[model samples]
Target: MSTVGLWVIGAGGHAKVVLEACRAAALPVAGVFDDDPAAAGRDLLGFSVAGAVPPPVRWRAERKRGILAVGSNRAREALATRLAGVDWATVVHPSAVVAPDVVLGPGVFVAPRVVINPGAVIGAHVILNTGAIVEHDCRIGDFTHVAPGSVLTGNVTLGRRVLFGAGAVAIPGVSVADDTVCGAGAVLTADVSSAGIVVGVPARAPR
Candidate 1:
């Protein structure tokens, strides 16, 4: 296979993790682009910072391939939209358990320790953080963020840009609508329709 030059669009911890995932998958990273120009030329886990996103055409023209390294669901959605015309690469860590029948869309980031069970469909630009469990037959929408240690029980369906907080738990068969936010450690037991912040056991909408 021909080596592809991959460009990363962020320079935070998530970017570092994504870089490693790209390396594990044998994709050569051209460099990272961050908002802070001062960050340019700085080393991140052995990868140099290139510049910022909506990067200079010269950079994009050179690399040709890119990945959105953002972790925020909203930001990811926006950035994905901004770079819609660019070729973005999906990076899945070698340690992640993604079932053969699972479908992953472009620019999705499946971090180490992620478990994507059989029949699951993860949409474009989704972020499956470390140790996140996406149980069988679940459908995760575009630009969604399943934070570290969160668990989505079987058949759960999450809409676009849905944010599941760190360690949150979504019980089986629940469906969360687009733009919803589940707070950290919350336990979702029912379907969530309105786009709002939800927290606590049996997850309730925040006041």
Candidate 2:
């Protein structure tokens, strides 16, 4: 890693947690940048939020490290892809229990007390929120957010841009398609092959 500190992109609630995780991991955070001009000069965890992010070329030339801290999967993916060549920083909270063989992709966030068992494959820019448990061999796709207290049993597969909501659980061997939204506290007992919101104890689209 470069001696220079990393920059956090976004100044929302999720950014707060990301900043804390970075601090807990002892990573120097340069500052936070948000597109919202109003966010500039506001205090975020004692750091000032800059009005604008550095240009993509500047990030490349300066070799700046950055992480996307937004909660929305689509927005996170957009911001990440836009900043081509920026060295994406992977952040894992100090308390996270990630297995030695877990394959974590660039810009992944493993939050406090999260457990990723061995052979799990986490894709780029994924967010494993606080206390989430990903059992062995689970495959998580890019920009997916396994929200706080969620659980994925062994061999569960999630597609890109999926939002496994807070406290949701997926039974073993289930697959969720891209862009699907698993509602908070929902349970997936089978496959979700469509992109839409699923809710209830055994999750299904509300129709």
RMSD, one per candidate, in order: 2.0, 1.2
Poorest lDDT segment (10 consecutive residues) of candidate 2? 1-10
Error at 2, model 2, angstroms: 3.9
lDDT of 2 by residue, 1-207 (tens): 343888999999999999999999999998799998889988999999978988888776666798999999999898887886778989999999999999999999999999999999999999999999999999999999999999999999999999999999999999999999999999999999989999998899997
**Over the stretch 68-91, how does candidate 1's per-residue lDDT look in tens digits?**
898877887777766667777888
Per-model C-alpha lDDT, please? 0.88, 0.93
Q: Candidate 1 — what's its lDDT?
A: 0.88
Which number leads on TM-score?
2
TM-score of 1: 0.92
